[model samples]
Target chain A: MSMIKTDKLIYEYAKLDDEGNVIGTNRAIDAVDLEVEPGQFVAILGHNGSGKSTLAKQLNAILTPTEGTVWVAGRNTKEPENIWDVRQSAGMVFQNPDNQIIGTVVEEDVGFGPENLGVPTDEIWTRVEESLKKVGMIEYRHHSPNKLSGGQKQRVAIAGVIAMRPQCIVLDEPTAMLDPNGRKEVLRTVEELRKKEKVTVILITHYMEEVVGADRVIVMDKGSIVMEGSPKRIFSRVEELKKYRLDVPQATLLAYELQKKGVKLPDGILSTEELVEALCQLN
Target chain B: MSIKLENINYVYSEGTAYRKQALKDVSIEIPHGQFVGIIGHTGSGKSTLIQHLNGLIKATDGVYYFNGENVYADGYNMKSLRNQVGLVFQYPEHQLFEIDVLSDVCFGPKNQGLSKEECEKRAREALEAVGFPGKFYSQSPFDLSGGQKRRVAIAGVLAMRPKVLVLDEPTAGLDPAGRDEILDQIAKLHKESGMTVILVSHSMEDIAKYVDRIIVMNQGSKLFDGTPKEVFSHYKELENVGLAAPQVTYIMHALKERGFRVDTSVTTIDEAVEEIAKVL
Candidate 1:
C-alpha cells in the first residue's frame, strides 16, 4: 500500500469581498492524482501560488479537499475519525524554523509532538534522545533553541517531527529561510533520516538544486501536476520547466546552454562534477 | 557621496551572561551608485550590519559617515538619515499591512510629511519602478501573491526616495523567475537612478550576476571585499566559513583540475560558457 495517495484532489477557497462575503471560489488545488510509496523520496517543485503547498496540506488533512480524496497510510484524510491516524502517519515540517519550534530547550521541543500524542514520560525522553541523535543535534539537547543557528533550529524542528515516528514526512519549503550551509544540513539530515527510518519523504521547494537528489520530481503549475518523472528525466525538459516559472539546477542549465551553443554535452547534468566531467571529455 | 564605517563593533547584551559581539572592528567604504552584495552565513552578523546602515541599530564603537555627514554626530536627524538609507527587511512581504497596495507604498513618503498627492505620485512611481502591474494597485496587499506582496513592500521603501537602498534577502521565499525579475529590476534601478544598492543575499549566483562588488562576512568581521571574480577566487576559503562561491566557480575549478584550460575565477554561467567554449 502507498504511504500517501491523492485521487483527483481538488481544493477551493471562497474569494471574499470587502465585507467578508464569498463572491466566488478560487481553485487552489485542481483535480490531481499523486501516489508515494513507503520510503520513497519525492520532491515537488513549483512557484509560489502554484498549489504545491496546498497539495502538501492535503497529505496531513490540514486542509481537507473540496472534492476528491486524499489517503495517508491507507486512511482517508477527509474522514474525521481517521484524521488522527492520518496525521500520525505523516509528519510535516514548515518553511520557518522559528515558527515551528515551540519549546525553549532543544530536547523539550523534540518531545512536544509525542507528548501531545499521549506518549508516556519515560518513552518521551527516550524518543527525544533518539530523534535528537538521528538529526545530529543530541549534543544540543539541553541548549536553548533561541541560541541555536538557523540550521540547528531546523534540525531540531525535524527532530520534533521524527519523535512522532510517522511513516512519512512532508516538508513544505523547509530550506526557504535558511542559508546555503543551513540548507545543506537540513537536506543531509532528511536524507539520513529517510535511510535509517525508512520513512517516505515528500519535499516541496523552489530551489532547483535541492531537488536534484530526489528519487522522483513532480512539477506543479496552475494548481495541477504539469510534469512528473525522475529528477534527471524531468530536468532534461529545461525549457518546459522555465515555462512554468521554475528553473533547472545551475549545472543542468549550464549544460543546456552549452548544448544550445552546439557543444555536444549530454542532457540534464545535475551537478558541478557531472558538468566538469562532460566538458573535460569534449575534445 | 558615500557610506563609510570605521572600526565598527556591536556587542549584544552587554555585561550579561549572554553577552556576545556580533560585529567586530568591521571597517568598509561604499561609494555612491555602487551595487554591492554582502554574503554571509546565518548568525554571521549580516542582518546586524545592514541594520547599522539606516541607524536602526547604533554601533557600540564606530564612526559612520553618510554622504560626508557624520551620522553619529550630536543632534543629527536620524529620521532623515533613514529616509536617505532605506532598509528592506527579510521576508518583506510580512511587513505589508495597508488596505491596498498603493496606499501601502504611500505610507513611507506620507510619513516623511509629503502632501497626499505627492505621496501617491511617489508611490505610483515606486510601484512602476518595481514592475508591479497597475491593475493590482487598488487590490488589498493581503490579496496579492507572495512575490507581488514582496514587490509592494519594496515599493513602500522605494517610495521614500532613498539614495542608498539596502535589501536583506529580498528573494528569500520567491521562486526562481520571481527572484530574477526582482534582481533585474533592482539592477535596472541602479543603472537608471544611479542610487547605491546594498543587497544582502545567500545565493552566490544572484550576487555574482548582479553586483559589481562583493563583501564576505564571517564571525562578525569582513573576510573579503573585492570584485566577483576576485572574491570568488577564494572559493575554498569561503567554504570553510559556511559560504560558497557560485556553482559555476566550482565547475570551472573542477574543469581546471581535470587539466582543462579554463578560468577558475569565472563566476556566472555566461562567463563559464564563453570560457569553456574558448578552451574547447
Candidate 2:
C-alpha cells in the first residue's frame, strides 16, 4: 500500500468581499492525483501560489478536500475517525523553524509530539533521545533552543516530528528561511531520516538545487500537477519548467545554454561535477 | 556621499551570563551608488550589522558617518538619517498591513509629514519603480501573492525616497523566477537611479551576478571584501566559513583541475560559458 495517495483532490476556499461575505470560490488545489510509496523520497517544486502547499496540507488533513479524497497510510483523511491516525502517520515540518519550535530546551521540544500522543514518560524520553541522535542533535539535548543556529533549530524541529514515529514526513519549504549551510544541514538530515528510519519523504521547495537528489520530482503550477518524472527526466525539459515559473539546477541550466550554443553536451546535467565531466569529454 | 563604520562592536546582553559579541571591530565604507552584497552564515551578525546602518541598533563601540555627518554626534537627527537609509527586513511581506497596496506604500512618506497628495504621488512612483501593476493599487495587500506582497513592502520603503537601500534576504521564500525578477528590478533601479544598494543574501549565485563588491562576514567580523571575481577566488576559505562561491565557480575550478584552461575566478554563468567556449 502507498504511504500517501491523493485521488483527484480538489480544495477550494471562499473568496470574500470587502464586507466579509463569500463572493465566490478560488480553487487552490484542482483535481490532482498523487501517490507516494513507503520510504520513497519525493520532491514537489512550484512557484508561489502554485498549490504545492495546499496539496501538502491535504496529506496531513490540515484541510479536508472540498472534493475527491486523500489517503495516508491506507486511511482516508476526510474521515473524522481516522484524523488522528492520519496525522500520526504523516508528520509535517513547516518553513520557519522558529514558529514550529516551542520548548525552551532542545530535548523537551523533541518530546512534545510524543507526549501529546499520550506516550508514557519513559517512552517519550527514549524517543526523544533516539530522534535527536538520528538528526545529529543529541549533543544539544539540554541546550536552549534560543541559542541554537537556524540549522540546529530546524533539525530539532525534524526531531520533534520523528519522535512521533510517523510513517511519512511532509516538509513545506523547510529550507526557505535558512542560510546555505543551514539548508544543506536540513537536507542531509532529511536524507538520513529516509535512509535510517525508512520514512517516506515529501519535500516541497522552491530551490532547484535542493531537489536534484530527490528520487522523484513533481512540478505544480496554478493548482495542478503540470509535470512529474525522475529528477533527471524532469530537468531535461528546462524550457517547460521555466514556462511554469520554475528553474532547473544551475549546472543543468549551464549545460542547456552550452548545448544551445552548439556544444554537444548531454541533456539534464544536474551537478557541477557532471557538467565538468561532460565539458571535458567534448574534445 | 558615503556611509562609514569604523571599529564597530556590538555585544548582545552585555554583562550578562549570555553575553556574546555579535560584531567585533568591524569597519566598512560604502560609497554612494555602489552595489554591495553581504554574505554570511546564520548568526554571523549579518542582521545585527545592517540594523546599525539605519540607527535601529546603536553599536557598542564605533564611529558611524553618513555623508560626512557623524551619525553618533550629540543631537544627531536619527529619524532623518533613517529616512535617508531605508532598511528592508527579511520576509518584508510580514510588514505589510494596509487595507490596500497603494496606501500601504504611502504610509512611509506620510509618516515623514508629507501631505496626503504628495504621499500618494510618492507611493505611486515607488510602486511603479518596483514594477507593481497599477491595476492592483487598490487591492488588499493580504490578497496579493508572496512575491507581489514582497514588492509592495519594498515599495513602501522606496516611497521614503531613501538614498541608500539595505535589503535583508528579500528573496528568502520566493521561487526561481520570482527571485530573478526582484533582483533584476533592483539591478535596474541601481543602474537608472544610482541609489546605493546593500543586499544581504545567502545565495552566492545572486551576489555574484548583481553586486559589484562582496563582503564576507564570519564570527562577527569582516572576513573578505572585494569584487565578485576576487572574493569568489577564495571559494575554499568561504566554504570553511559555511559559505561558498556560485555553482559556476565550482564548475570552472573543476574544469581547470581536469586540465582544461578555464578561468576559475569566473563566478557568473555567462562568464563561465564564454570562458569554457574559448577553452573548448
Candidate 3:
C-alpha cells in the first residue's frame, strides 16, 4: 500500500468577514492526486499560498479535505476514528523552529511527542536518545533549546518528530528561516534520518537546490500538481519551471544560460561536478 | 556625507556570566550613495552592525560618526537621524498594521511630522517606486500577497525619504521572481535617486550582482571588506567561517580544478556564461 495517497483532494475554506460571516469560499487546494510509496523521498515545490501547506496538512489530518479523500497508511484522514492512526503514521515539522519547540531542554522536547502518545517513561527516553543520535544532536540533549542555533534547533525539531515513531515525515519548509549553513545541516540530517529510520519523507520547500536530492519532485501551482517527475527530469525544462515563478539550482541555471549562448552542454546539470564535466568535454 | 564607525564594540547582557560580545572593534566607512553588501553567518554581528547605522542600538563602546557628527553625543537629534537613515528589518511586512496599504506607507512620513497632504504625496511616490499599483492603495495590507505585502512594507520605509536605506535580507522568504522584483526596484532607486543602499543578505549571488562593495563579518569582527572580486577570491576563508561564495564561484573553481583554463573570479551567471563561451 502507498504510504500516502490523495485522490482528487479538494480543500476549501470560508472567506470570513469581520462579523464572522462566511462571505465566500476560497479553494485553497483544488482537485489534486498524489501517491507516495514507503521509504521514498519526495519533494513538493511551490510559491507561498500555493496550497502546498494545505496539502501537507491533509496528510496528517490537521485539515480534512473539503471534497474527495486523503489516506495515510490505508486510514482515511476524514474519519474521526482514524485521525489518531493517521497522525501516528505521518508527523509534521514546520518552518519556524522557535514555534515548534516546546521543551526547555533539548531532549525533553524530543520526548514530548512520544509522551503525549502514552508511551511508557523508559521507552520515551530510549526513543529520545535514538532520535537525537539520528539527527547528530545527541551531545546537546541536555542543553536549552533557546541557546541552540537555528540549525541546531531545527534538528531538535526533526528529532521530536522522529521520536513519535511515525512511518512518514512531512516537513513544510523546515529550513526556510535558516542560513545556508543551517539549511545544509538540516537537509543532511533529514537525509540521514531517511537512511536510518527508512521513513517516507515528504519535504515542501522553496529552495530549488534542496530539491535536487529528492527521489522525485512535485511542482504545484494554484493548488494543482503541474509537474511531477525525478529532479533531473523536472529541472531539465528550466523555462517551464520559471513560468511557475520557481528557480533551478545554480549549476542548472549556468548550464541553461550556457546552452542559450549556444554552448553544447547537456540539460539539467544538477551539480557543479556535472557542469564541470560537460564543460570539460567541450575541449 | 559619510557614515564612519571606529572601534565599535557591542556587548549583549553585560555584567553577567552569560554576557556575549556581539561586535568587536569593528570599523568601516560608507561614502554617500554607495551600495554595500554585508554577508555573514547567523549571530556574526550583521544585525548589530546595521542597527548601528540607523542609531537603533548604541554601541556599548567605541565612536560612531554619521556625516562627521558623533551620533552618541548628547542632544544628537536621533529622531532626525533615524529620519535620515531608514532601516527595514527582515520580513518587514509583519510590521504593517494600518488598515490600508497607502496609509501604511504614509505612517512613516506622518510620524516624521509631515503634513497630511505631504504624507500622501510621499507615500504615493514611494509606492510607485516599489512598483505597487495605485489600484491597491485602499486595500488592506493583509489582503495582499506575500510579495506585495513585503513591497508595501518597503514602501513604508522609502516614504520617509531617507538618504540611506539598510535592508536586512529584504528578499528573504520571497519567490525567485519576487526577489528579482524587489532587488530591481532597489537598484533602480540607487541609480535614479543616488540614495545609499546597504543590503544585508545570505545569498552571495545577490550581493555579487547588485553591490559595488562587499563586507564580510565573521565571529564579531570585520573579516574582509573590498570589491566583490577581491573578497570572493578568498573562498576558502568564507567556507571556514560557515559561509561561501556564490554557487557559480565554486563551479568556476571546479572548472579550474578540472584543468580548464577558466577565470574563477566570475560571480554572476552572465559573467560565468561569457567566460565559459570563450573557453568553448
In candidate 1 the C-alpha lDDT for residue A201 amounts to 97
Candidate 1 residue A68 C-alpha distance from true site, Å: 0.4
What is the per-residue lDDT of model 2 for residues B1-280, given as tens digits with 9 covering 90 to 100?
5999999999999999989999999999999999999999999999999999999999999999999899999999999999999999999999899899999999999999999999999999999999999999999999999999999999999999999999999999999999999999999999999999999999999999999999999999999999999999998899899998899988888888899988789988899789988988
- Name the candidate that leads on lDDT: 2
**lDDT by residue for model 1 (A115-147), tens:** 999999999999999999999999999999999
**TM-score, each model?**
0.99, 0.99, 0.98
Off by over 4 Å in 3: none
lDDT of 3 by residue, A48-135 (tens): 7788999999999999999999999999999999988888889999988999999999999999999999999999999999999999
Tens-digit lDDT string for candidate 2 (A75-164): 999999998899999999999999999999999999999999999999999999999999999999999999898988999999999999
Give me the runs in candidate 1 sitting further than 4 Å from their true place. Answer: none
Supply candidate 3's per-residue lDDT for A256. Answer: 94
Local error of candidate 2 at residue A208 (angstroms): 0.6
Better of 2 and 3 by lDDT: 2
**DockQ (Cα-based) per candidate?**
0.85, 0.86, 0.72
Ranking by lDDT, best first?
A: 2, 1, 3
Residues B157-274, model 1: lDDT tens digits = 9999999999999999899999999999999999999999999999999999999999999999999999999999998899899888898888887888889888788999899889
Off by over 4 Å in 2: none
